[model samples]
Target: MSQNNAIYKGFKVSAKVRQAPDAFPGGDVVHPRFLATVTITQVSTGMGSQRLLPPEIQQFADAPHAAITLALTSAREAIDGMSTFVKAK
Candidate 1:
């Protein structure tokens, strides 16, 4: 089966992207504009599924890979920041 998600820093990240609506009148929809979504959940949560950050939405006009990559980067940064907070206090 194909993998649509990745485990990173003990967090599960799944991505979904939608094609952009038709740019021209009655023209074919293009991927030049995509709505990207990334959901991050802890790998092991004592309490039911715990999400570090709420579902994030990103607008991209590039390839899905680029969008996913950006989403992952944002997730990692958020996770790292959260880790710092937890460790600081």
Candidate 2:
């Protein structure tokens, strides 16, 4: 697993890359797939954290860096208010 963090539009965007689970129940991962996750947190006081993307194995990238990039982009959209992610309680 790899993690990266950045501050964007007063929101803290944290992203991480994780390897997807094996396709078969007891088989090796023939082609490893990397999945990414993004968590967006409000930097201001009295704000809560929000998960921009779920860490599902169904969505993956060919490379770890690519996965991280994908996660960050999604977080950026949410932080920019372009996404429908819930802002506050």
Candidate 3:
């Protein structure tokens, strides 16, 4: 997926999509399934940040672009939430 990289609240958000077999058999015709992964890292330190979201299984989609969009949205929301917590302290 293109435009998979984003910067949010001083952190870098990188998104990638991977193909995975469907848990349940798809009788007759099988369709491709994709999982989107989002990685957040500190731009200043280049260190990996903790995942604010849950497992990739919850972010799966039938279409690659939809999966990527979901990943990007989740990543940005996580960054925003983290920043808000830091400022609260």
lDDT by residue for model 1 (1-89), tens: 11258787677877777665546577756547655677777886644445456566454546666666776677677777664223222
Clashes of each: 0, 0, 0
lDDT of the structure predicted as candidate 1: 0.63
Q: Per TM-score, what order, best first?
A: 2, 3, 1
What Cα-based lDDT does every candidate model obtain?
Answer: 0.63, 0.68, 0.68
Q: What is the C-alpha lDDT profile of model 2 across 16-57, one tens digit per residue?
A: 788977475877556878888787766743245443433322
Sort all candidates by lDDT, best to worst. 2, 3, 1
Can you write out model 3's per-residue Cα lDDT over 1-89, one digit (the tens) per residue? 44477777777778888775765664545578888888877665334434343333236788888988888888776766653333222
Flag the better candidate by lDDT, 2 or 3. 2
For model 2, the stretches where C-alpha displacement exceeds 4 angstroms are 24-30, 45-59, 82-89
- For TM-score, the strongest prediction is 2
- Residue 18, candidate 1: Cα error in Å is 1.5
TM-score of predicted model 2?
Answer: 0.65
The residue pairs that clash in candidate 3, if any, are: none
